[model samples]
Target: MSYQDIRSTFKLISGGLSETIDDSPKEFVSASITDTRLMGVVSMCVHWRLPENSHLTDLHQFFYFDAEESGFETYRSVLGNGGPSEVQEINDIEDYLMGGLGGKRVILTEREVRYMLQSYVDLNLRSGLSLPEDKDEYEFMLSPRVRLTDSEEYVLMCKQCPGLDSPYQVINYFLMRCVGKDFGAAKFLTKGYVRTNLFPNHKGATLLRNVIEDSPDAVSGSNTDYHVTDDDKDFGTFNTFKSYMCESLIEYSGKFFLLITQITLDHLKIVKYEKISEFQVSAAEASMMTSRPEFITVTDLVPSAPEFDRHTTKLTSKSMVTDYENGQLFMIFQPHNDHVKNATYLLNDDVLGVYYLLEDNQLILASYNLSDIRRMELDLAESSMAPYIVPVSKYEFKDPVLFDFINSSFDDFEDFVATITKPPAE
Candidate 1:
């Protein structure tokens, strides 16, 4: 039968069959189960007759009836004949409706029915399926079990039921309608696309908002306007180069060295001012030097001295000398005619300490010690002559490994010279 017809039939039978024993409140209290599977069980109670002048009795009896089952006969047997009650399978809705009805039957008005249903809803929210000790556990029990299969249905229900504002009520309704055994609403709620509008403005909704906002898909965007271009890549590369240049200065003691082929007059002035103040060549002199033959012999530039060693026996005119003293001066000599080549030799043959060469406005400064060349490079760079400072070697070593070993082990130029020039260990 239809739900309204069943409710109306239950109301008529309950009112007509109720036994009125005393004038002590003829009010009939009734609760109904709306579950279709349970066939709607009704619990009705009414006050029983008491002896005159006898104290009000505490004992009260309530009749359990279901019209969808065996009808009035079964109810009468249970209530009137006092026979063995039939075992009836009860669900959550039936258990909730039948509880705390006392033992009196009464007809409930529409307002009373609504109030009782609201109370049942409230009680279910407060205590969940059972009275759990933890409030969070109770909330979990009331929360909807939304499975992947039923998620669409639950979402539709949420959209349709605009009046269901309470999160607990919405969850409970969805859970009651769901057929799946496994549920994962919490995991689903963490996804970015899930709609949270149906949820009440509570802590769970707030947390869901945070989760959505923090999601990778939510935080990232696909805007074509923000995409990187070749210009941006170039700019990034430029910035990286600038950073490397700046850091290299720190690595090399606040100085940058470069091997450059060309040098301007202005660059020459910076080199002269910062490094070599004794550079007496004028612009006219530099121009004159570049115009001469590219190949010039060492004898033409500087006079050679007699080779000698202070530690060993004095060298005679015919003796051949392979090595020299530590402080001995030498001339800057280039083996080949090419000025572009940076490899220059410091003649082991004794010679004056100072010599200068100029080609195409490029100046080469040479001295007996390596420290002077390093100092000149530093001063030139400090004066913004970084592009003009050449990385040419001042002298070629007989043993390149020994030279490198000394350079690596010693920071002081004097120590390097002393260590390299010391007598061989016995």
Candidate 2:
């Protein structure tokens, strides 16, 4: 395997890391979007210049060798003459590569990339000295199941999902699933966001700004119309994680957008509050005293909601709806249809399309046409804070006297927390 060939392999599969492919007929790799992030850059840097990192060099060699030894390939860049001809250091190669020795591409962090390469190395080590050192041979000999893709929901639920235990797994798991469902959902309606961490360097700038918010608390008001409208750095910078995944989702979402909750979680949580943002959320319907726990999926969460009898899209007469992938056409159909009685459809990011149920029968084919729908929202995940997720209905919040009683009667804030968090019936 040459460097360019290996890099090409990485690049070809970079966008859809969690996808199942026949690297070999019998071998299966459980690649998830969340875990396969390493591969994205691996593909990019095969022919691109990478920043230098002393610690990551060995790990890089391991990856380079893995690709090469396993039928992959690489080529030393032919440096153009008249460029600065100073070399001869342990770090000289990276500099040579960066100095137009190779073209630039998406920059993968040395640390994160090594985390992925090292994971494979460690996994190989644990399997012992007898582990196949031959890359092609190893792929040729894996259990067939190893090559199949795991369900997006199951992968995320793994939290410590062993099958996808690398930066590759992390990247692939989240991105593939998002591409199939989350990103597509954002395409039609509802607000979405991409959140990430802050760097140490930004602290000083943040502190300087804090001195000016003038209020003892530099950032104030958890939710209101003002914060969403207010253009403030208080939300933070767009990092690489957001840059990579959100951009993909953005392009796929058909360009329908309103106020974005890209800045901060706190800012987003309050988007629905009247005092919160100019962008209005669809108001709640006439909710009655059927039960409160039904809001949660895990029956154990509220005891009153049904158990996990089967994944079904049973909606109360008042709820708005969308398909598992949130496709606009599917989303639009729910307002006028009773989903529970229609054909069932499930999202299969592991595959190319939605797994649909045919009309008057249980034939599970992957499509939207000529199907009798029977269920919905089986594996959908939404945060109480998500703009689309309606937590409290208007009917429940309309009576100011009752609302105040619930809020104020809880004594201090801690009591309030416990009260709302108790059994749904409570």
Candidate 3:
């Protein structure tokens, strides 16, 4: 094929790469090359920058024409880039393209480079070459199953969970899941924060400064409330083959919270503290939750409280509730008004709304109709009455004590370590 025709084919492949890959590199370049050893055998070279830790920005991949196979084959497939031979081939191609004028090779634009990098990955995948470990980590980061751990009660409700290989995964499965995206739960209810190595250059700790009694010191990376050190012998573990993931329920400042951590002998990879609302009968409930060791579906977490279940059923079923202009009218028949039985209800004088608890212990505030309130005040007790409810807000009361217990703490950090961990025998 002519150089234009070959370039056209590569352009099409790169375009397809652009549409598919989400975390494609922003800086990269591609150039055409020819091998003097193999006549008419052309190759495409892709180069990209690396992270600061890599110590080198110049890294490359070479896709070459295979005369025997009559197709382009991946020449440099592993982590290391192609060496001198590939560089000479590129120089030869540049000389030919420049008509022996000896000019610099053309660098692909930022947009083109992104596609080129993805194209390099796609070709490597098709050729059955080993991908970089970081690429695999990135794939895990983008997975839907991994991201699902960012929901409240996800890890707590989970009967079976895959072993977390990194601190990021640990954070998602515990802290992020408990508090969600906003720092709302941590700000108003909890008294702790999460520390992780997920963002190395950025701040290591996140959320819950207001409730924590002590301010973060300079030694512990002042961005957080407090920090733990590697020298602390209590965290030392002999097992190094597999990572350690520990969870605990704690009571501090007279409030309850869950502590989940992934650590090693030298590094405390991740630590999260999330507040919980209830503690009674949590031991019995926690035992039942962990009884099954298999993965569970969303249906398993459906609210089980009797009154809440009945109310949800009615709301979902169109016949039991009527949708008015501004709100829903819940029908209550005098003879049998058991749908909302045994459920906690509270009235808010400030907003003139009612707050009710669901089977799952989620508190929901609903606005009442002024006309309905007036009718009740006038002593009009009809056979059937409708209480207009406009769903305003809701909050979940995840009981920390119900968590599958790995450990617990109420003592200060120093005392906790000393009590839990004993010094090695002399």
Candidate 4:
């Protein structure tokens, strides 16, 4: 069944299932078993805190639920990081113990992802078994916001769609359908990104649109049937897009990062900003969530250095951008005092990862990846989390030099370079 159908069934059977983990109870919830990450792990979170000390320290021995066998089992990965363990099968499969993005799963928010790395020193994390220290570097590899996947492609075989014969027109329709609900027709066309912006010079679609227009007479004869239906026009919009895709426009269309959709850019342009100015001090509220190294080496930020230890929502604008480097960019804008964070970000280059700098907070296109972001199990009772993420760029960084300078200024830049630029030590 589809996600919607299955979701309806879950609501009907469970009678408003609520999830309560730790001391907190999430009221009225339902569960489903579709796609999820960390197949062997499922969490029940009633609170955000972890216990003082979790008995389980060895990342290799974590338990996972085996959906196929209807029992708990182990999953073997050839490229293993070893955070999973095998527990004995349970005869009683309770309601909360079902599969997928349900249960007390910890949603990796921006603050949560930052807390994970700097707070915990024990747990090692993995993203597809590939862990990068900083968020921006990791975010550089995620799926882009505007992408067309192939398991089942949307095809407009019928024609009545406007720009049916134009590939770009079809894409515009798709984007229009996929964008935010409130975008009206005039706002999009008046001051929006046009297809011509992406393929500057009308290079790709120019010839195709021309061919269709000129072929009406040649297909049959002079004035054979110079007519098209409303349905045909709509479908034509869809067909032009599908035909170009099938003819390999997507595969060979080199510049995928040229983001051009009516509603997307509108959403990106923000009027207010909360930005962190300097590095946060060790004693500030920022330091309260993130843990400092116990040894207190020179490599660490001097707890008294007001310059490197201050925390604000502001970040340098020109930060280096990668596909999903760590989706960990911590940017500061002039308007807001707090940075909007995201553990997941969409990239211009067709990738997705944990992005720290939030889209809503700043007009800039970067997220920060601290040197400490890691993966660890949160033990409820103690307000501590060890989440890891990669920061990604929402759009291209027009300036390269400034981008590098901002990221390298952070302490974690050394670690970020090592993980993403080289293979892990064997």
Q: What is the per-residue lDDT of model 2 for residues 1-426, given as tens digits with 9 covering 90 to 100?
A: 111211224211111111122231221112111222211212212211222322211111112212112212221221111133412221233332222111123333333333334444444465442232334322322222222134632332232222322322233323222322323211111123332211212111100000001112223334322333333445452221111111111111122111222221232121111111112222121111111211111111232333221122222111211222211111112221111111121111111112222121111212122121213222222212122222221112222122222224332222443565588764
Cα RMSD (angstroms) for every candidate in the order listed? 44.1, 23.8, 27.2, 21.8
User: How many steric overlaps does candidate 4 have?
Assistant: 104
Candidate 4, residues 1-426: lDDT per residue as tens digits? 111122213211111111222223112122212112112123221112213224321111112322111122222111112233212121012222233222233333333222222212112222122222222322321323223233211121111012223233333333222221212221222222322222233222101100011111111212112233486577663122111111111101222112211211111221111111112122233222221121000122223322211122111221112222322342221121011111111111111111232222211222222221121001101211111122222222222222342344333433433454587679
TM-score of 3: 0.17
Tens-place lDDT per residue, model 3, 100-166, is 1111233333333233345435545676655443343123222222112244233221211233244
Worst 10 residues of 4 by lDDT: 206-215
Order the candidates by TM-score, highest first: 4, 2, 3, 1
Question: lDDT, candidate 3, residue 113?
Answer: 29
What TM value does model 1 have? Answer: 0.14
* Residue 167 lDDT in candidate 3: 34
Which is superior by TM-score, 1 or 3?
A: 3
Off by over 4 Å in 3: 1-26, 29-41, 65-70, 77-107, 110-426
State the local distance difference test value for candidate 3.
0.29
Runs of candidate 2 with Cα error greater than 4 angstroms are: 1-218, 223-249, 253-255, 262-426
| Model 1 clashing residue pairs (backbone) | 28-106, 28-107, 29-106, 45-104, 45-105, 46-104, 46-105, 61-103
For candidate 1, lDDT tens digit of each residue in 1-426? 111211233221121121322233322233332221111233432223333323432112333433222222111111122122211312221222233111122343333333333333354455443221222211221224323335643542222222323222222222212111111322221212222222122111000000001112111222111233587587673122100000000001221121111101111010000110111234344223222111111111112312222111111111111221222211222122121111221112111122222212222333233554454334334543334344443443333222232225443333444676899999
Could you tell me the lDDT of residue 347 within candidate 1? 13
